[model samples]
Target: MLPSTSILFLCFLCCLSPIVPTSLNLTLPHQHPDPEAVVEKLQWKLNVSLSRRQMLGNDGKGTSSGSPSSFSCLTGNPIDDCWRCDPNWASNRQRLADCGIGFGHAAMGGKGGQIYIVTDSSDPDPANPKPGTLRFAVIQEQPLWIIFSGDMMIKLRYELIVNSYKTIDGRGANVHVTGGGCITLQYVSNVIIHNIHVHHCYPAGNTNIRSSPTHLGWRTKSDGDGISIFGARNIWIDHCSLSYCTDGLIDAIMGSTAITISNSHFSHHNEVMLLGHSDGYVLDEGMQVTIAFNRFGEKLVQRMPRCRRGYIHVVNNDFTYWEMYAIGGSANPTINSQGNRYIAPADVYAKEVTKRVDTDEKDWTNWNWRTEGDILVNGAFFVPSGEGLGVLYAKASSVEPKSAGLIQQLTLNAGVFGDPRDSVSVGFSGGTTTSGSSTSNNGGGDYFGMIFGGSAAPPPPSLTITTALLSLLVIIILNSRHPLLYYIHPLLKHST
Candidate 1:
């Protein structure tokens, strides 16, 4: 095996290599929907997600189980509080689709599709992918709730072009797409990628790759992003762990919008996330993204989403560590930061969380960048620009803001792991039982009987009466014949 330094050097060389595409395949898909309508719908979803909490009040830490080491079933956050803690999550996986919040709430990825199990881990061919492989599962036309038969590491020879209406669900098993080309969602819609690990991706392309059953196109070199969203909308990436890629860990550029990245962990990289393609690219002005309930942890540098022209809502995330700066942008993006815990580094000069890249103060001072209800520590401070602004910043305020004090509870389970005992620690404190006791996983959700290292298979949550009620509310709204916003507004109408 090569050293980590040697591996990084090779990845760098691969990224710099020039590989051009010779064939143009026009049948895949492309979309540039109007951001005005998309943001209005997103704004509505955020309001509905908030409506339930008002109905339930400010309680999150539910009555504890009698066990000495037990986690409260409800975590006080709207998304997770929607019965993800129900021990039956493994059997009723489709229910997870209705719990989305923020901009990507409407992305119902493969909710009604067949459950396709990936039994093979090898990607022997990029163009003619075999059945039972993950590559084949994602490129299919029909909606699919894709799952892994067991723990597998799928390395690709080229970027995995995810088709629309697909959900890559990695709940009961450990799924990894690493050590080569990673995922690319270009001009697609309604896609969800959850609970997977994507890392150590080097540039892989410059060859023929298949996107669907009959279409294969020449692909140029990729940026090796863990997940690259290009001209795609209505996408959600949740509870995934991303790190150490050749380029940005997650880059949504070239007119992507209506996206939410929540409950995920990011670390050990430079230029962590890029929200826009370029300053001169006018199409990216339509981008709207929500970064919520995520944990940005150790060994990470700047660009925890460096923005361009767009509307970005940064809500209730835990920034326990960062060098240089945490949030950055250029091209007069409207940034609304609310209820995040920002702990700056020891360096005095790097305390500010916001960076208006390359632009002079005269131009950036007029930008609508404001931090509300944020908790800054260790000499950390946020420079609020264009305060008292209502219209543009309100577009970014689609998501409701929780108190930063609740960040520890909101983001405790940011990343994915099969067993709690084996989960990687982000070095931030949270209330959890490492004993792995009191959490039961019985019946057919055995997870191949291998995930828990021969112990009990620990799911995300255990059940409670409150969580059951919460789940019922979500089910009612999702199943209602009327539009979602109409149902939620009346429910929250009587409340303040």
Candidate 2:
């Protein structure tokens, strides 16, 4: 008989042979030799050094410094004037004086505008305040929630730009803005709009009457964009929830830059965020915007904002059930999309490729090349052609004829449908020709319907088979090791 040690060694060698699982058919790409090591290296590179507050700071400090003046100090019945009658009012009278509409005047001094209090329902009347007027007032000890009862709408005639460092302190009461109108800001910086619920604004373009032509305009169609910012910079929109209107949830047209939108939830809108010009020209600089830590869900269709010649940084946003494109860019913009959690449907990959192809054919080679990183599970490639275009590659299955046909369609649709991805083909792909259209369509098309054909069929299950086999092989190797090869078994065998 073979010696015990030799027999055990031979058994170990037998167990060491490759064990493939029964369920697998197709070959899998080789597993990375050290996946954990690869992840470690990537984490080191992608780590962001700034803290959450530091990254989202308004005016260099991330925190809101003071309580809003609108609701600061108050007892019972501010409109009734009972709190002003107290005996100890002298010591706290300064706090009460500081409590009203112009509380920030000490800090603001003469540089900011005056403060006006709207005590009655008559204050917002266009006639009372008059048009092109600046009225500042404090409601005095009244909870800020009182401002929402259609009282603020009376001041519609005057352009109500909250200067003098105004704060509508809620003082534990909720202040909401309902009904729709434009709030215009001129030469205003270091502004903070916080802790307020603004909703049910009337749709834009519905009313025939007009406010100031240049500073403020009439309510037009409710495209669903809740708020409007005209020519404002260093603005921070945080901790707010907006719903139920028309167009985009937040529309930044014209040239508005250095804006940060963080820690908000958006849903039920067509275009959630829009950053571009209405006329489509390259301005001096586009909007420099950052979107982070927001949650999105169940969009009706593609709802990405268009960024033109701007810097957009999208990080750490969770997208649950994105029915259409989660994020998209346009114009000659720079977009950085990183650290996002996305749950996309199966056809997302095919749809994305088609969109890119369509975008490249438009705009006559004006599309800028930027970096894009996406994570997909069990996706496949269908190349319309077998070559890589500039920053664009046909999937593996695309033949030259099919690629050419698709390119031709893309060019024709360019004039009618603008590039949604805002890509223009500058150079030719290998064995491909460049084409153009006469008119501009602003990157709109039915490419998705064509690429997907009908309903989006589920992808094949080949990936599942490969994964099962790898797991089975690992299990087999671990279990097959010798029972008596280690220390406990060697002594017993030797005694026997």
Per-residue lDDT for 394 in model 1? Answer: 33
Stretches of candidate 2 exceeding 4 Å from the true structure: 1-171, 182-187, 204-224, 298-300, 345-358, 361-496
* lDDT of the structure predicted as candidate 1: 0.69
Worst 10 residues of 1 by lDDT: 447-456
How would you encode candidate 1's per-residue C-alpha lDDT over 322-404 as one tens digit per residue? 88999999987767675576777879989888898999999776677756546666667677665323322334333443433
lDDT agreement with native, every candidate: 0.69, 0.34
Tell me the deviation in Å of residue 447 in model 2: 33
* lDDT per residue (tens digit) for residues 152-198 in model 2: 33323322333323333222224344454423332233333333444
TM-score of each: 0.71, 0.44
Span of 10 residues, lowest total lDDT, candidate 2: 446-455
